[model samples]
Target chain A: MSTNNEIEKLRESEERYRTMIEMACDAIFVVDAESGSVCEVNQSGLIMTGLAIEEIVGRPVWELFPEDERDRGRELFDTAVREERGRRTSMHFVRPDGGRVTLDVTTALMRLSGRKIVVQVCRDATERDEFERQQARLSQYYERLLDSLPVGLGIRAAINATPKIEFENQTLKRMFDTAACKGSGITWDACRADMDEQPRIAITDDGSYAEERRLANGQTFLYTISYVRDLLDQWCEVTIVQDFTRRRQLEDDLEQVNRTLEARVQERTRELEEKQTQLAQAEKMASLGSLVAGVAHEINTPLGALTSNNDLFIRAIVRLKKLLDTSEVTSDAAMKERFDRILDSIDEVTSVNKTAGERIKNIVNSLRSFARLDRSEKDRVDIRDGLESTLTLVSHELKNRVEVVRRYGDIPPINCFPNQINQVFMNLLVNASHAIKDKGVITIRTALEGGWVVVEISDTGSGIPKDVLPKIFDPGFTTKGSGVGTGLGLSIVHQIIQDHGGKILVTSKPGEGTTFRIELPAR
Target chain B: MTASSNTDAGRSGTIVIVDDEEMVLTSLRSFLTLETDYEVQSFLSAKEALQYIGANDIDVVMSDYLMPEMDGISFLAEVKKIRPEVPRIILTGYADKENAIKAINDVGLFQYIEKPWDNDDLLIILRNGMEKQRLMKKLQQKIEEINRAYGELEGLHKEIVKTFV
Candidate 1:
């Protein structure tokens, strides 16, 4: 009764094993050890080979492999029986329709019904192998794309605890000395140590780090380091390097060009200002020339009448003297009295004419010295001469309205163009006189400083405003009303003084007064 | 002085002077009258001087170059028309010397004198001008007398020819 129960239990166990094998996702094969023939196969194995169970049951297992892989399949089957276990390997199986499929196979030694056999299990690996090959191709494409770029690119991957150089593009290798970089592996610490002398590392707002390095070869490079997740979600360090030498050279050249252009613009502006000043001076000279002609006519008219009167006096005196010397006229008291009355009248007339002649002479002399038309060359002249003549010329403008006070100093003569210097004095004196509205005083002071002759002209009249003071020496800057001033006086004065290697300065108060100070070289 | 004395002894005529300025006329008249025996007539207006010249005999006419009514050139030109034998002189200022000189030939002027002339030079010019006028008058009188004498001689020849026939 116990033996019958044991047989029934064994049959049930066999059926359970068969059901488990048929339900498995992988294909299962049972091979005879001695004959290397297929003894059993699962439904998955039959479906994988596209063969009937009858055709595969007694056939050699190596026959199911492709013709080229049959030998390796047979050796693996024999090794499984001899070694009792076999490693997993990939093998190609041929279907009866001549199609092929890749499979991952594992074998083990087994004993069934007192016979030694091999049990092999294989899984369809076609899709998995194709996916892995695609992954490899994509990785190689990415590396080639990085190597084609001008900018150097590299990657360091952390494995376990140490960072290892996982990838480096061709550009990154060419940018640095490969032999030196190999000796000291590329790491953040190693790079920092390399730039110890001039360490420049900047952390950006985005948490990326950037560094600039100048090598011993005078090559400049910029590096940007970033951390990112790679394909397998592992932490990686990415570095990008760029050469900056050409960009720096271009910037320097542009700066040099800009400086030269700025200098040229300033020089051109100065030349244009000089030309404008010369044109104004020529206009002034033309007006003065016409004035000279009018003055000449004025002098001639008075001169003609005075000369005739002088001759008349000479004749009258001689005739009267002759009459007085006559004996007949001396004896007659009546004749003598009449003669004396005529002599008295003649004496009064001569005195009046003498005064008029003196006036004409003085005016002619003043005009001659003021213009200095005869002296075309430079002359050593006292400054007082110019001041006096300028005072004479501007006296008509200042008379009755203004009073002038002169404070002269003892100074050596100066070598200069007397006419231009005289014009400067005239312009300043006239300007001073015009400053007075109803009544004021003009004070002219002169002194001798070291190597310079200083002349100060001050007016006690309406003064220039502080805002208008700085632009007073610029041409066409005028405070006077229209048609009253030409506005070129101060600028002309400045130009003439500068030509003589001298200086002019002015100080003014709004309501108090204004003063013009001039310094001329005493050479 | 010697030239003045010489002119004073021989020169005598009615000298007419015209000027806008009274002082100029007075000065010129005084110098001429005191130094020469010639009779001097002074007028301020050129028109008035022309009237006087037309009525009387004058040896020389002197006029100032600038005047209100007429310039010296035009006034002298009028004088030449009235008395063709009179010598005209222009007195001008230095400023008007150029214009005066240009008008001298146009007006048949004997000379132009700049203002404030020297007394001796004035006397010499007047004496020479008067001599030229005197010679012109003498020449005209001699030509008239020769014509009359020739007419009488021609009448006598006609009468003698009638008696001989």
Candidate 2:
């Protein structure tokens, strides 16, 4: 009975220790210094070291460490066992996969029922180590993204009625003439863009664009600012700055081109209007002149006979009066003394009638010639004749105000429509006469230029202002204030010459005088 | 030059003047009395002159154009109807080319004159004008008298008609 009880108890103790070892998830082992071996290991030890109990039953515990760390590990284990002091150490734990696990090992001396041994407990730390490394990598990635962005970015706080820069990127710090972003910060509106007061750009905030402005220094930058509610829903502004000076210069050039186009359109409109009015005026004046000429020719034919009859009638009456006077003064004294008076009266009446008739003939001849203008109508005639006729027609208006200094060139009849050409001359002469608001000299000259017939008229009148010179030919553009300017006189002159394929030039100086030069295509 | 030379020929004539305007009439009367030798008879309108033409001896006729009812062209046409041999002259202030051509071709008017005429030219034209009128009237009168003298020829024609019948 004693033998049976003793055997049973031994078996139970062994079973209890084995159960403890199997349930533990860490490696459990025993090191025997005298044998230089591991006496036992737990389930985790078997799986971690990739060995079965038979494969490692007596192997040296130091072998679990790499060759480089084995001696140090062994010394540590020996000190912990001899001193009866527990110790913890980390060691390289090799695995079946040919990789390694780091082991956090605990060792202490312990006595089993009949033996003394050192116990080591190792926990695998690889999983915790990997988790920590992953966290470190994530942090580094975030830092790099923040530092490398190109836009000059700045974060500012909106407080105290101004923006205060809280943070600025490297680029933002370099701009704004500051080592750090300062100045209660800059508002979206206050900050200049392209170095201008209004900077236009695309932004993420509610307002996407701003206008471009120029700064006094001439340096340029474009800034865009966005205001957002962050995670805490606090208002914050992010400003982005870019330089757009070159684009603004291009826009300015584009504006200048638009202005030039507008000016050209206006000029073309004026020129066309002038042409239309001039053509109408030319048609009217020509028809009127022709009608007058025809009338004068018809009158000349009949006046020729009527005056001759009048001459004969006057002679007959005079002869009759002379016969009566002879009878009144007869030598017979029987005649009354009053007969002398009657005879005197009859002679006086005849003489008066004769003189008056002669005067009537002169008035009629002048009127007929005035209409005929034959001297002007006939080619190769003297220009003086046309000028005189024009003077006669407008003589009532001229009287004393205008002093005409006509420097008549040997104006050969270069091929021309005499009546029509005379009209041009008349209009210019009249305009020169009218130009003088007061008394002034009008110099009219005509001559032959090379391959061209030139007519020049000058007036010592109120000259066109310098700025008005370019606009003189423009219809409805005149210096004769208010309703004074028909404004079409010079414009008509300009077109008539042009219709003749001639060129007209005007030279004027303010307060000095004006000269009109005409070049006609010579026939 | 041709016109002046032709007009210088005659030294004496009885000239009849016609016009509406008193100034023209008086001045013309005085001018003829002073400047040329001719017996003067003056009337304002063609109606007044028509009476003189029948009874009074007149050497020439000169009329103004554009009278209210009787224009110079129409008056000359009427005178031609009365005596085709009459030398009539028309005076006008207007060109009136259409009317002038009408007068010359249709009425056989002697002349078309525009106003404001030369004095010497007028006298020369009248001298020629008077001679033309005298010759036309004498020839016309002789033809009439010959026709009157030859009326028995028509009686002879009636006798011949009865014989033919």
Candidate 3:
């Protein structure tokens, strides 16, 4: 009765072991240790090999493997048996349908029922291997992408309160000289210590900041550091370094070009202003030339008549002397009468010549004062003198149509360019003369007031119109007939007054008259 | 030449002077009357002088340029039409010298004298002009005598040809 009870318990325990083996996810095999053949296989083992129980059980374990993997399988089995220990290896099996599967096999030597056997546990490793290979390829591609960037990139992390260079791209290695940085561990703080000047860094609440640093090797760099979470979910700093030397140089070059262009434009403007002044001066000279010609003709007319009369006087005297020397004057009454007539003729000639001489002297004096050619430089001169000379110069134009009345006052001389002042007066006087149609009167008045010499020239003629008054001093503005006046005259007058530090004003009534008032500094 | 001898030698022709200035006319008349025996006639207007030249036999005509009635060149050109043999001289201001020189070529004038001229130069010019007038008259007389002699000779030749025929 005791032997039957023990046999029933043993069978029950064996059946339970068989059921557990069949329910396992991994394949299980029991091989004969001496023959190196598969003596038993679980349900998973058959499924893994794609073979039936008959095909797998009692077969050589090396034969269950592919042709190329049979040697490796046999070697694993032999090692397990000879060492009387367990062995782990990877092996491939070929199914009857020519399909392949990879497995991780762990073998152990055991004695069951006094027979030596190998227990093999195998798990399919194909999916895990493929996942590991894809992971490796992706890692390689990411590294290459970072290396190709223009800006140097680096990652730093504080592991256990100590900063470490987690990763650095190829560009960052080249920029920081990885060989030299090896001694310092290639941290940003270490690189700052190598610089000539330490830059100030300000980080915001976002844990990202940028700074410019000048290295001891004469390189300028911009560092942008950003704090980001890495793949391991740890915070790290990413630094992007850009060289700023070339950009700064280009900016400086552009500023210099701008400065040079402004200078050239200013020089060209100055040249154009000089040319305009020269043109106005040429116009003034041309008008003066014509006035000189008229003056020369005026002087020559009297000079010719006086010279001829003087010659006749000399001849009459010579004849009278001849008669006296011959002693024929006392003897003949006719000769005495002829002598008296000759003396009378001489007297007449003397009187006419004296008038002509005075006329010549006045004309020459007026011309000299009008031009003031020798006194072009600034001098202390009476404004009245300039006015008087200018009046004389334009007297021919004013002779028939315009009458001039002078109201002189006791005024002091002023410091000025006398020639230029005279020119201004001449232009005004001529313009005043031209304003009249048939007959009119011009009044000139001078006075001294508050350290200024004031001159007023008024004409009773056709005055300037209201519409044309504002533009009278603009260059190339004219009211006179085309052949009669140059438009630059009044503009030149205004310029000359400004140069002398003087002021000019005008008032006009279209039909009644026009008046020009000038105030010059008395210095 | 001695003044007396020069006056005696030039005692023949008539010199007519025209100018707008009375002073110029007076001065010229006095000088001509005192220095030479020739008749000196002066006029303030070129028109009156032109009329005088047409009516009388004048030796020389002197005019002033820049006159109001007629310019010296135009007056002289008129004188040329009436009495083409008359030697015409122009007295001009210095400023008008260029125009006077141009007119000299245009009008076939004797000479142009600038204003304020030397008295000696004037005398020389006047003397040469009168001498030209005298020579021209002498040539005209000689030509007239030759014509009279030729006419007589032609008449003699005709008589001899009649006798021979």
Candidate 4:
């Protein structure tokens, strides 16, 4: 019926079909359309159907099916032949090893030489279904996780311009007084009053949990807010609120305590300043009283001399008058000699009077200066007056023992407390005069440098001992022999100068002369 | 020239002592009148002394450094302008080094003396004050004499020119 070339073509096509069926991973079974016999079968199909090709060959593919299901398998195969297409269906097959394999069977019809063949592609779908069931269990587990989480979490549906509450976790329901504040979509405005003001969270597309929040129980919290945008870009705000209310309260209390402490410290400082001012005033008054006493002692000496000289002059004049009254033209040598002696005595009295009177006037001027201070308390005082006054006060000490040389310079009036400055100079001068037992020169000089007035007092005297030098400015410390000086002299001097913001430096050697350098700010 | 109309050195000049304290003024006046040849007056205030100075012939003016109304420095400076030849001196109690320097530099202070002063030292200062006063007067006389000679020479030259013409 067929030539060799045509037979060869048919055989070749059949061989290609056989190769495709045998090598397939899926279960492939070919059924004869007209005879309903099993024409071809793959290894998986034979293993899956619990029947070998020898038993199934030239027999209907429905033969291996159980008697009840043989009709169903035959109907499905007949439909594929009629439709010439395949569609998926779930089915159970008895395997060669006596196990059952659930499969998704797809039957396709192929036509060749007026005969229709059914090619069934069966897929082993049991493992895939089992995986799907496991995934469903995992989804239930996640739902349980979201329910039991300790932190207060919430989801809001922002379908409209104003977001509405869609879901609230258990923790959130507990934090707020759920009976009142929960259901009607509570927002920041509803809770941000004295009743409850909690920290608000931010909404962002990218998730970052903020460790800050506010609870509805009138307590602030620390937590984060995340904005979950949907496919429509409408943001659903998911906030994770945490409680840090106690920490905030602690910080507030600490700030309040710090402020109170600062206020107390400032008050104590003010009190200390006031005490310093009062102490300075008291020291000044004490020095003034001592100065008055010194001046009083000085005035008495000259007054005594003047009184004696006056008595001498009056007596001499009376004696000369008496002698003249007695002698009228007599050549009395004794009377003339007496008159000459009386005249000489009167001259001596006149000279002494002049001397003592000037001395008294000097002492008086010094007292006047020492007592007077500018009523304004501080003023531009002629610094020379202060120095001259100090010189006048201490001149007696220097009279014969020390030769005081004034190497004075021009200096303008400087703003200061004049009397206090004078007292400091008086102490230094007196000490210098005291340092010398015999004759030595005390040189006082002054200059202006760097907008400041400098005064230097140099003395040729037995200097302070090196061992006692550092103690010179200490209160109640003295280098002079006891009874000769008050140890407070240098201390008082040092304090007064320091109070006025002046500098005093003393340079000395045991046997060499001493020099005191003083610098005062100029007005 | 403060010489009495008859140019003589024997005429004693008046000396005024100005102090802020009443005790010092009274006591110093009494001592000076009783002991010295000069007519001495004491003023308790620099203002009063200034007022007295306008009409009086004062050769020497002594003032205190510190005072209530005005300090001795200002008063002495004012006195120097009014009567330039009168010698002025400042006496004070404190031996303030800077004040002494300012006093000497600002006002040519005749001398600076301290309290409890030596009697001989005071005498020497007073003598020096009187000597300065005398010297200033003599200088003024010499300056007047030189002026008079200069005027005479000018007159003689004019006369000689007229004769030559």
Candidate 5:
């Protein structure tokens, strides 16, 4: 009964071994260790080589491999048999259809039926090898792409606890001192030490964050960081840094240039405005001068004729008297009496004519001088002369309407353009006369004050309005009705005075009087 | 008139006055005739005056400046070309000193008189011009008489050379 039990146990053990081998995912085969011949193959082994059991069972193991791999296969088999343990290797096999199968093979010495035997279990490692190679190639491609970026790129994992740097390109490594930046906590320390100011970034639930930092080397950078998961599904951060120093400097320089250009343009505009005002004033003065010259020319001719005729009449009367004294006409009382009467009458008429003619001549002369037709040259002129000439020219307007008062002092002649100075006097006198309504006093006072010659023209007429006084010297500013005054008179006067290195001032009270004070340098 | 007529009529010299204005012309003519021993002739245009002067023995030529057709300086220059020995005077209403100096230097003007001139002053200028012309004529006549005498002497010497040598 014990012998029967032992036999049954042996049978059951054999069946279990057969079932395990047939259902295994790997291919299992047995070969003769000395001859390197295949003894038996399981179902999976036959399927792996795409062969029948008969075709593999009695074939040499070297025949399954290519000619090149036969020697290596024999060596593995010899080694396994000597050691009495299995040895693993990987090799390619050729099937009957001329296709290739890559196998993970193992060889061992087994004592089955008291014969030297070899067993091999081969798993199809082609798929797993292909997956590992693809992964390696993809990683290399991403490394090259990151290297090609203009900005520095780096990858880090677990920034808080036991921080680790997984990957870093050449640029990031170079910027952070390769050895120091290889890890996480050290990289943060390097970043802090390199920045001039504290980096500005706010960390929230991770997506992306940016920091602008200035380095101690006077270089600026913007760091853009993105949270990502690597192929292994581990959380990491990607940092993209861009240099911003040069661009910031360029922007600052542009702003400074814009400000300078704007200031220059405003200054040039002010100069142009001043020149335009001076041009308008010059035009007004030129036209007035021409008109005065024309009037003076017209009046001087007739006056010359009248004065000459009067002179002739006087000469004739003198001749008649001489004849009466030297000739025999003295014997005739009637003739003598007639000649004396004629002489007396001629004398009275000649006196009156001479006085009137001189007055007209003086006015005409004053107009001519005031016109200043040839005003290219300046002369040493008495200020009083200019004032008197201007007064004489405007005498017609001021005759009965205004009383003239003169307070002339002993002041030296000033070196000046007489025409311009005379123009100033004329404008002041005319303005004063116009201010008078019905018989008011116009006082012209001149004196030497310090290093200046001062002329004060005052009028007791309707004074300038308080609000209008400040702008009286401004071009085109006038309170007079349109077409009555050009409004450039006082402006021209002010310009002329300024051009001569002088000053003009006005003091006026409404309904009281107005005084124009002109100060000219004495020299 | 009486003073002028009392002087020797035959000795009185002739004068020419050129003026554009009729009144100025009449006044000058009357004044010259009444105040001086000169027979006066007047013309309204410079061309007429030049034509008359070309045919007359004028002692003094007085012309007004600023006239139509010709100015006083140019008229005087023309008279100088016709009778360079005649004295010229310019009368102008517009007494521009530059024009007067120009007339004096270029036309050899004897006088620049401003019009409506003083009668006595103008009379003095006219008298001086006539006196200079008279003195020049007298000197010229004396030179002619001497030339005549020398010609006669030359004729006599030639005759003697022909007869004795």
Candidate 6:
């Protein structure tokens, strides 16, 4: 009964081995080691070779290999049989129909029916090798693309209070070459400190952002940072840095140019306004000149007739008297009385006419000289003459209100436009006259001081106030009643003096007097 | 020249006046006739005055400036051409002073009197011009008489010399 049990056990073990060989996923086959022939093959082995069982059972294993691989295949089988060892190799096969197969093969020596045989196991490896090669190529391409980027790129992580620089591209490596910390192994804390502001990068947000920072070396950087989840699902910040100093400097220069251009435009506008004012003043003076010429021409004719008529009346009366003296008209007491009455009446008329004619003549002469109607050209002008003419023109206004004193010194004539200079004198003299209340003294003094002819007009009257004196020559500045002054008189005087390369100075004590001194170039 | 005598003082030489204004002409003629002892002739136009001067013996020619047909300066210049020895006077307005000065320098003007002139001054100036003109004519007559007498004496001397030789 024990012998029977042993036989059954051995039989059961052999059946289990057969079943295991048949069901193995790998192709298992038995080959004759000495002849390199296939002795038996499993169902999987037949399917792997694409062959029938009769064609594979006794076929030489070398026939299954390609021509070039048959020699190595035979040698591996022989080595496994003679050395009683197991061997493994990758074998290339050519099927009967010229199709190629690549297999991972293992040959082991086995005793079958008391003869040494080789058991071969093969697994198809073409798909796995192809997959592995594709993975290697993809990784190489990705590395090359990362190194060629323009902006410096870095991956950073700060976890559990330990900051790490996980990956830095080739651009980052080159950038760090010139940085304070000259390596790619940089911490998040170090990078944050290098930035101009705090909170260098945020990984909580999933979108991209940009920021600008200046370094200690005066270099400006614009960094664009984006959040990325790595393969381990750990969040990190990706930073892209660009130098933007040159662009910022260009913008600043453009702004400065705009400011300068605006200032120049304002200056040009002011200059044009000043020129326009000068043109208006010149036009006014020219019209005044023509008007004066017309008045002078009109008045002189009538004045001549009136003056001559007075002379004629006086001569006629005298002639009649001479006749009476010669006793040619038969004189008597009554006739003599009548002749005396007529002579006295004629004398009275002649005196009145003479006074009236002289006054008219003086007025006409003043108007003509004050206008300087025919003196447009710059010539040698006597400053004293200008002052005298201005005084004469305003004599009516100053007749009883002011006493005039003339203290004139010998001075050379100035080279100037007489008309404009006379206008200045007229403005000052009239202003002096108007300043007096009831009765005051006006002193006009002239002198030669260094290369200049100086005429000083001083008035003992209500003087200009200290607060008002400085603004006297500004356009539209006036202290007089609105209709009493156009306010352009002193400003024009000042402008005319400046145009002649001259100066006017005023000194005043309120309630005491005011003095205007004009200096003109003598040459 | 006729000296100023008591009897002929009111009836002396003739004075001609040319003026555009009738009032001025009448006044001037009346004044000259009454005050001075000169005969006066008046004309409204310078052309008429020229024609009258051409027909008559005139001692002085007075003309007003700014006339219609011809101004005083031009009229005086024309009168000087007609009678070189006659004195010319201009009655100018004050505005015509520049033209009057030019006339005096260019036309040998004896004098220029502004309008509404003094009667005494006009009479005196006219009397002087008339006296000067009369003296010049008399001097010419005397010179002619002397030349004629000398010619006669030369003819007698020549006859005597010829007979002696």
What's each prediction's TM-score? 0.55, 0.46, 0.48, 0.37, 0.63, 0.60
Q: Please give the ranking of all candidate structures by lDDT, highest first, separated by commas.
A: 1, 3, 5, 6, 4, 2
Model 5 agreement with the true structure over B2-88: per-residue lDDT tens digits: 454437433368889888777777777766666666789998899999999999888989988778699888999999999999999
User: What digit string (tens of lDDT, one per residue) describes model 4 on residues A349-456?
Assistant: 777776767676666667556544222266787778878877887777888778878877888888877766777788788888877768899999988888889999
lDDT of 1 by residue, A1-523 (tens): 7888888899899999999999998999988898988989999988888889999998998888888999999888888988887678999877557778788989889888899989889998888999999989998888889999898887889545667888878887776655655555633225545543484689988888988775443445677889999989998988887765576467667888888888999989877886678676756664564465346445644465575667668666876677676757667888788877888788777877767766665565456567664453588999799889778878899999899998888888999988788889998888888788889999999999998999999999788988899999888888887897778788889998998999999999877889999999986
Rank order (by TM-score, best first): 5, 6, 1, 3, 2, 4
Docking band of candidate 4: incorrect
Per-residue lDDT over B43-154 for candidate 3, one digit per residue giving the tens place of the 0 to 100 score:
9999999999999999999998879989888999999999999999998753534455788989999988866566678878988999999999899999999999999999
Q: What TM-score does structure 4 among the candidates reach?
A: 0.37
List model 5 lDDT by residue over A1-523, tens digit each: 7888888988898889888988899988888887777877888888778888888888887677788788887777778888999788898877668777677888777787688888878888888889889999998898888877777787788467766777778766566554434543335324656666888785646658888777655556678888787778877878777766687677678888889999999989866765677777567557766676556544544655577567667767777777779899777898888878878988998989988988877776676567555453577878797788888888888988898999998899998888788888888888888888888999989999998999999999899888898999887788788999877788878888998999999999889899999999997
lDDT per residue for candidate 3 within A34-128, as digits (tens), equals 98788888998888888899988888887777789988888888899999999898788665577676788899999988999999888888887
Cα lDDT over the full model 5: 0.79
- Candidate 5 runs further than 4 Å off: A1-298, A316-350, A374-383, A407-416, A437-470, A501-523, B1-15, B93-108, B113-121, B131-165
lDDT of model 6 at residue B69?
Answer: 84
What lDDT tens digits, residue by residue, belong to model 6 across residues A355-405? 888777767666766666656778787878877888888888899779999
Best by DockQ: 5
Cα miss at A272, model 1 (Å)?
Answer: 3.8
Candidate 5 residue pairs that clash: none
Question: Residue B163, candidate 4: how far off, in angstroms?
Answer: 1.5
- For every candidate, the chain B TM-score is 0.92, 0.71, 0.93, 0.86, 0.91, 0.89
User: In candidate 2, what are the lDDT values of residues A1-523, reduced to their tens digit?
Assistant: 8778878988887889789887899898877756658998888989888888988779878777779889977887888767887898878877789888888888888777666688888889798678768778876665455546765677777645766776666655455554222443533334453243443445445684543445544445566666777667778877676545566667777899989999999989877777679667756655564666565645444444454554555455555545655674554554534555665676676567657655555544444344443333335544456556565665556678888787877655555445555566676777677778888888888787787777788988778778878877756666668898777766776666776778999898766688988887666
Q: Give the winner by TM-score: 2 or 5.
A: 5
User: In terms of TM-score, which candidate is strongest?
Assistant: 5
TM-score value, chain A, candidate 5: 0.57
